[model samples]
Target: MRLVAAAVTFGAVLATLSGCGSDGPSGPVDAGGAQGRRAPGVTALPATDPTLIPDVGERLQRRIPADTGQVLVVYGEGENSPDSTAVFYMKEGPEWQRVARWAAHNGRKGWTVEHYSGDDRSPVGVFGLTDAGGVLDDPGSRLPYDQDYVAYAPTVNAVAYDHVFDYVIAIDYNRLPGTVPHNPTRPLGEDRGGGIWLHLDHGDGTSGCVSLPKGAMKFLLRTLDPAQHPVMVMGDERELRA
Candidate 1:
């Protein structure tokens, strides 16, 4: 059954790439910086910056909740671009510190607040990080982990989905927390969107989820601590600053 699914998905992905028209992510070019406002009480940028990415610390200070100490910023190159950069940060004494960085990919069409299922656009804004699971065994993750094929189905191109679920961090978009990340129960209605996750990259754009290299996925799984109240601040460069 898995093989059959993979075959089907691969063909579909190829056809989509060839412009066969399956309603893939093909939205307008993004006009970033749509949402930026520094939050209160955040001052003094970090003294020691680890990564070369610009303005993310300042933008996150205004976006993330005060209580959030751990953040995964998925900064996209543009609103409609598939490429992005993922950086993990931990709050230091007064500012955030970059712990890790990796090349990542977002939805085919970029980002949108009014995301829907099969829209090919990732949702913008801050969201809490909760449950996680994958096709492989647990990797010392702090959060609950499910290692079932059902939880990690290869719905996309089988090649792309291959090992994509080897590790996954479920973003609390429209689903209930504490449950298995694969739970199909979407709180915001199925159409409103659900199942947005950070998973292993396949070297291609995802339907509407963020993808990182397998190594990075494993690193994230091992590093994300639930006690720190980890959350994701994702969006185009400009909007993230806003």
Candidate 2:
């Protein structure tokens, strides 16, 4: 069965909080002076710390591009489980910091390293995040956004699949990058499957794409930057640890 392109909409307003604090020494300075000392209760990590992508094994971690500053990790519960978690991380200096995490769903049949057409399993490995689009208008996405209602509209189960394509980030798995998520140009051929995306969840697993909450989808659409060279690392927990 051909995979249907999922749609997603992003118009949710996000609130931001800022705090003001006085900048003065709260405690005594050490012998190295204030510049060398951390805040009273703060601890410092060495420059050579190597936990860049937490929970990811060496093999998968090495696949991440050296210049990539943003990473989305989809940790499936099991090889045959649809339930999973999606965590977003941003690179700060030499460390990777957790930004946000949300409950997510993968393919109905789970994950696979050898994904194919109609497999009902989300592909596992590192893939670039380059383009986005949906049936709705763009919501401040930093990546190239394509807004096509006709091409992105859900073809089956209209009521049940409504709003799934409101916001979508194309996962460059088997398709050409830099094109709209709905684009059908699969460089790896049709049998490998294509059109996999990170779209809004419809309370269940997808045919091949990964699904996230509406709020999470909106947040990702607005936050994932093309300049950051973002990539997604996805697989079951066990395989990710390998």
Candidate 3:
């Protein structure tokens, strides 16, 4: 199925974008079944980037080469298990193609995936192109005073024990207090994990934010077109997060 992209839209982000160009080819193939003409610097695609972890192969062998961003997340309704999805990121060169993959951490059962303070189970739905923050180089007033940050949520999550990356994005699929809970298309910090941005895995991993390798997360945060509306495909079931 075709993904729906994200919400943000910035045309002057000094981005090295291609898949969004007008001259690019699109639509269904002809009855004769002709091949697509690949772009000069950019290769022909089926929509969406290709380099995310979940888009790789079996096991955790994708960590070695380390190449994600401009990803193509392969998922659907039913369940949001790790294998249930295939996340692709950028690799090789400027061409956005699939490389790595992963089995996402979707919601478990009763508990929802929140960043602030709630049960630990990833959310389930399609997210828009969100922002990125870093607790490592943040200039905020809350936090441990000494702790910096860079997360998806410009303002949310009050705890400061450290999880993984320098950021965290609130997964919309929960019932928290200070946060927007789990609603689609809402801005950050709506509820609590609003401060949730993508970050590295510390050990305890995540509260709700998507936890990936530091390098992967960094590439994604930067690769995202600050002007385009990128989409996040997520869901979970049995073999997820295992």
Cα misplacement distance, residue 110 of candidate 2 (Å): 0.3
Candidates in order have lDDT scores of: 0.69, 0.73, 0.34
Candidate 3 error regions (>4 Å): 1-86, 89-117, 138-165, 169-196, 203-205, 237-242
Question: Which candidate would rank higher by TM-score, 1 or 2?
Answer: 2
TM-score for candidate 3: 0.41
Give lDDT tens digits, candidate 2, residues 1-242.
11111001111111220110012111111211123323211123332344467678789999999878779888787898887877676665556655556667899999999999999999999999999988888867888999998877875676768888888899999988887788899888999999999988777788889987666666667667776689999998888879
| lDDT tens digits, residue span 95-152, model 3 | 4434333223222221233434455444544444443445545323121122334322
Per-residue lDDT for 2-90 in model 1, tens only? 33543443334233322211222211111111113221111224334542223554655565676666788787888888878776666
* Model 1: residues with Cα > 4 Å off, grouped in runs: 1-63
Worst 10 residues of 1 by lDDT: 26-35
TM-score of 2: 0.80
What value does the lDDT take at residue 200 in candidate 3? 49
Ranking by TM-score: 2, 1, 3
